[model samples]
Target chain A: MKALDSFNPLAVFVYFMASAGIAMFSMDPVILLLSMLGAVTLFVIRREGRQTGTHLFSLFLFLTLTVINPLFQHNGRTVLFVLNDNPITLEALLYGADAAAMVVSVLYWFRSFSSIITSDKLLYLFGLLSPKPALMISMALRFVPLFRMQAKRTDMAQRALGKYKEDNAIDFIRMKLSVFSIMVSWALENGIITADSMAARGYGTGRRTCFSPYKFRPQDALLLGLSLMLAGAVGAAMALGGLEFAFYPTVSKISPDFLRLAAYIAYALLSFLPATIEIGDALKWQYLRSRI
Target chain B: MKPIRNEKLRRTVRYLVPFVLAPGFVALGITVFHEKRYAFISLCIAVSAVALFATGFDKKRTGSRRLVIVSVLTALSIVGRFIPIFKPVTALTVLTGMYLGAESGFLAGSLTAVLSNFYFGQGPWTPFQMLSWGLLGFLAGILAEPLKRSRVLLFIYGIIAGALYSFIMDVWTVVWYNGDFSIKLYLAALVSAIPYTVSYVVSNVVFLWVFAKPFGEKLTRMHIKYGI
Candidate 1:
């Protein structure tokens, strides 16, 4: 069962750029809420529930941001309460929540983004522009896990050599520093070897050829076209002031006009596109299994 | 025929691009424009341009060796973030700057923030982290000779780098809280972040004191050997 994530790297990249770009840039609460809902739906569909607990920090951040805004900003006319001679306004609180939603939704979108676009896909995208930075990124990504493994091995070797017998804090710090230095020296040595190998292979001598497994299929084109169209529609609406809402001074009345409604629908559709694709694939799989 | 002039151009660009041009665009975006979106886009563009230019410059001179070294250093910085309290990222970034040229150091610092954010979660703060660390690395490179000569200077720079990082991040905080930048709000934000800023300073100084010598020695050896 191929999911939307298995599409061409360009398609995934475009989809995320559009969705996350909108999620980060749009300030309207309704648009932000829809984006958040869509992002959460995708996370659920992807069965990333276990990772949700780790995001509690972001939730804390959202809450803190939301609470802190009304304290510092007293721009609205309708004062909700007075705390320590400072007025807390409804507009300020609402604005805080909206801003917090923007941050949190963008975070969630990026969470799914990183999962969907692996390092190879990222490199492929970057490689199109310049192969040098792309190569650097790929190497850096590779070295992260490699260095972690080396650090662990160094630690284990040090422990085996009875270096961990020191029960004092200073000695523990000294031991850790020594291990880190060993790791740094080892990494430097390995890097030279890699550089030599790359040179021997004539890495910078000619135009680079990209050997990616991803292929742009008809469906990928269709999906990309649809995403662009949806994004374009949303952008047009925003340009036309259909999604405009002022939070400071006073919360502006949200006029439920037809164009605004259509824009909201388009944005919701765009944001939820990944979840829809995943669910549709799951349903089709289940239906085929049942028929069999 | 124009080789000497070209060398002068390269030398000027090596200093001017990251320190002047990049921060200039970012400042223009934030101060000249009222739109937060444009400001953010400008910041991103500036950071990316600086990173790409630095790496490109390094690649032209040292080829892939500098790239590999920067990547490895960035990886180490990322891994250093996993250490619970006292993060060694600033120390390592500074060391890389002191050993590898400023361009490699800037690339390593910026790349570390961006790459580590993949695991820590990305937000608007990611670019700020990149810019702050990148600038710190750039400064370290400019001061590399003196820094390498004196441990005291290195530790002082580490403290300054930590403070500078916190200060820049607090600007982002103030802007996020209030839709626009205000000096009063920024001051308040700084005051509020005093405790965290102190911790950052302490950790940076402590880590630099501990890790600089060993890492600097190895990196110096590698730099001489590989000419990277």
Candidate 2:
């Protein structure tokens, strides 16, 4: 199995949730920086960093979020300049940048998350919690593709029947509306049929059991344990106020103490863990290939 | 088919879960996780509320056909969201609510937000989006009669839904930025969000005006014919 695939979905889910949660909740620059680095590293490693468009979009989001915070918020003391007779202070700007970093890092983490956690994995996770929602998700996912194909066919048939000319904006909207209504009626009718078929096959009649190929091996356990421990460290730091960084009226100093240093290191290790595994896995495969 | 064992119990569960638990979670987030993590905590509350709402629609009571129909509507709404400009998600959801009942409408709206986000990319904003859209459809379901009786009222309701959607989302924006709700910041967010809100209102009105008659007829026919 591939190194990334070797980890169970549950383990991966836990790791991402913990990583993204810390990134979302914490305002500390050190933690945010580590999160950004880790997320970017994973993206680069997994996708080979070829997705320029999304990178640009992320940068744009970061810039907009960073700039927008200072305009409305005027609580800071260190005055940078005045726009419209309002002092745009350094504190608000710094807070904006920090908030932007937090948002962007979380975004990156989720992007990686979407890539790693496939629908089947999500279904598996959800099935463990609640079966009905999982079934609904599966059904919805199934219908999305089916409906797309049906919509295409419906559009083609409508055009062949001379139903819509689409010569103007009004005509275009009319065509879309006609097609959508047709799909709804068609889907509702077929959905009943689908349900009848399911009923015949004994759905919702007996105890439900979910089948998944994933096994909780030693590596999965190890990964899950490591993530939980690291996340616990960060949570403890948060509870103890070791991770606090205030930026309201004035900026507070980030004095490095033992607990703060330990929390930072723990978060750094946690964030980099996935990328480290990826790198190690790549090197190991290369060594094996060379020996062969 | 087994009927709902206790209608009163189900109703209590349906109402209490979202109302009681959502605020309880927010309280927990504020006290335990601190104000800094309020957004994250609220997100948790949103997810749980959606999940609880979904679970309340038991397959035995609603039947598998209703579930399938809800899923189909959700898929359609997700696809509608992808259409260039002027999304019909709200119009479609409102119709679903008007015909299928409030629970299904809530399911379709919330599911559309989440499942579509799978393609558009999920973020901290996702749960809030789900809740907002879900609320619109739920309210539409509650006011289905008045909305159906008069075209003018339906259009006005559509406009109100758009504004309501924007209002809830502004709540998310303020909470996310400040880590707590402040009235002044919320007002600023609402003002700055006017253009987007107008667009939301327009799209809802436009789509409803265009598709309501045709789609409403189809849904009405299906409900009568198939008893779905």
Candidate 3:
């Protein structure tokens, strides 16, 4: 539910990544579509809807993508229209829909990931791989919002000075060059300070341990087992060619059709792990609250 | 004269601090992780690492106001890169050239291309990014003195520049994707590229509108200080 309350960012990350990996080789378009839908739904359900702007724009964008993609790619058997010299096919539209679904789905996965799995969780999970790489990622992610804030403050201060007035090309050029020079210095100083502060904390040294709020209880283990089962089933389905379908000629030709359907179900279930856990946590917390 | 020189060096350091460290590590991770042909990733790492290591180059005092102005311009330029109108590299290059002169433009333009990849994925285009953005900055410096007019003049220049920007990126993509000289793919790419190509232009135009005069004024103030 919250980054602070998560067992391991790695668990969630591994699940989504595995699903994405599975989705890529999915023989049945139906399976891919379900996984895509599953990812979006998870995205919607997560983050406490704090940054609603991104969510709103994401909806509009996904809709536009769905509508417009088919118009551009007119290469399919079932012609939806014959405009002048070209034919618009149902296949192309469907294909576009698929692509749109894929893109939006991926974006949704990323959004949910950022919300539920903050840097700390991610670091705790993957930090063992390499200290330098982990620190760099954490620092960069942390810097984005900070840099944006700093840039604003700097702008305001400069604007207040009334020094931002120059005439003619040569003078204008001269003025901006100096401005850039100063900004760069500010950035470097900030960076050095951050790096120094981080280093002083003994960050990447000697048997690194992370304190997790959520303990690995029985339910967590059960969830983990279920997750593994679902993942395995999904993989088995894809390898058997269960969920691959194309719309160019007609909806035809994907292998192990029954197995593919089973795989899709497993994939969908697997994608819902975070949502399920968060909701379960929310309910448990609410129940405890209600009891109290 | 010696006092002025020391002052200038300090000012230069003040300007370069952030640009050096932030993307420097990014370039390094990218260098080691994603190994591919062209040693492009290594080049990126080298450029940013070199820049970062040089942070101690200046110890002179730089006016915070001057830093503020460049910060605004740089931020706007980064936002411009996201618009997908003109190629990010081209808009960055042109902007660098127009405001910062040849040398600075070159660095800014190239750095933008490499740095912006932090948002998007980095791949074979890293070298091309350096070249394209750097060249745009170089060209901007060349054209800076004469171009003074309304938004329309800028828009026109941006469009032309956007087209040129697309040309280079497309050429590179063809090489990266191992695309043969197929008229079909070319036609598809050319037509499809309009949004991305024009985005650079539209965004740069927007950026120019918002920050141009303010940034220009600040730079001139700094130049006056540094005797550049």
What RMSD, rounded to one decimal, does every model reach? 5.4, 3.9, 12.2
Which tens-of-lDDT digit does each residue in B38-144 have in candidate 3? 23333344344333322321122223332223333344455445644343345545655676565456545554554455555343355566666666666667778
Model 3, residue A275: distance off in Å is 2.5
Would you estimate the TM-scores of all the predictions? 0.86, 0.90, 0.54
Q: How much lDDT does each candidate structure score?
A: 0.78, 0.83, 0.54
The TM-score ranking, best first, is 2, 1, 3
Score candidate 2 by DockQ. 0.42
Give the docking tier of candidate 2. acceptable
DockQ top scorer: 2
Q: Per-residue alpha-carbon lDDT of model 2 for B57-84, expressed as tens digits?
A: 6534777888888888888888888876
Q: Which predicted model would earn the best TM-score?
A: 2
Candidate 3 or 2, higher TM-score: 2
In CAPRI terms, model 3 is classed as: incorrect
Better of 1 and 3 by lDDT: 1
lDDT of 2 by residue, A1-292 (tens): 2366667899998999999988888888899999999998888788833479878988998998888778878879899999998889899898888888888888899888887777778777766655666678888899989999999999999888886676878788788777877888788889889999999999988755466778888888888999999999988888787888889889988889988999999999999999989899999889999998
What lDDT, from 0 to 1, does candidate 3 have?
0.54
Residue A216 lDDT (model 2): 84
